[model samples]
Target: MPFTQAFINESFRFKTLLPLNLMRSSVENSSILGNFIPKNTRVLANIWAVHNDPKVWLNPQIFNPNRFLTDDGKEVIKIDALIPFSTGKEILKTIPLVKQFK
Candidate 1:
């Protein structure tokens, strides 16, 4: 069962159905990872970039469902970089509904 969940997450991360999540905007001036941003700047989280980043993931391009499984292989590891639905209040609200449907 855990491996099943891991496989699903890995598939979602690798496939990246949307490629890019909904665009986001800065509510006020902000700085991110040494990058500065003015208020109301439109920003998009490149789903593909984050999912495929070598720094965040090992062999990101390779389809490896085992990556999400723990060494014991009994539990699925939660990967922060895997954000197929993006993240925020809206997504948090929708998650339960999605789970129910799924």
Candidate 2:
């Protein structure tokens, strides 16, 4: 069941439904990735870019559910970068709802 869930997760990450996150305004001046972000600046995050980032996932372009599996292959490892539907409170409750299990 865990591997199946991992596969579903990888599938979502492989072809993200919504690649762009909701636009957010900076409440205050902040620096991100060494760049200056002024207050009131509209900022949008790219979920696809993060999902495919080399720094975050090894061989990210390849469809590998094992990336979300534990070493023993008995449990699914939660990955913070697998956000196909952008980021929000709902994103925190991400869980595959498939009913079949072997």
Candidate 3:
């Protein structure tokens, strides 16, 4: 998919997918991997790569929002593999805004 207007418009149904997309970009862009690892280091920066890895997701390159949607398409919840914002991060900066429509 070209990821143009139609894809953007349809994204409303898969709100959580937005963060996943961002994380994928972040991981792909970073080069900290294979460079250095200081002793006693606890945090890592390859979260994005991990989320979209082929071993983790089916057809990761394809933008399938339905992957995150419930089988019945009723509700959406964050899956452990899709951690884009990281745990205990600032809520204000990572929270997704829900839009109410009439």
Indicate which candidate wins on TM-score. 1
Model 3, residue 96: C-alpha shift (Å): 23
| Global local distance difference test of model 3 | 0.41
Task: Please say which candidate is ahead in TM-score: 2 or 3.
Answer: 2
For model 2, what is the alpha-carbon lDDT of residue 28?
Answer: 89
lDDT of candidate 1 at residue 15, scale 0 to 100? 90
Weakest lDDT window of 10 consecutive positions for candidate 1:
93-102
Write out the backbone clash pairs for model 3.
none
lDDT of 2 by residue, 1-102 (tens): 998999999999998887777887778887654567699998666777767778678998899999999999999998766776766644524322100000
lDDT value for candidate 1? 0.73
Across residues 1-102, which tens digit of lDDT does each residue of candidate 3 receive? 333433442343334333333221222322242344344444333444544556656776677766655576555544445544443333213222100000
Ranking by lDDT: 1, 2, 3
Model 1 CA RMSD to the hidden true structure, in angstroms:
8.3
RMSD of each: 8.3, 9.4, 12.9
TM-score of 2: 0.77
**lDDT (C-alpha, whole model) for all candidates:** 0.73, 0.73, 0.41
List the lowest-lDDT window of 10 residues for candidate 2.
93-102
Better of 2 and 3 by lDDT: 2
TM-score ranking from best candidate downward: 1, 2, 3
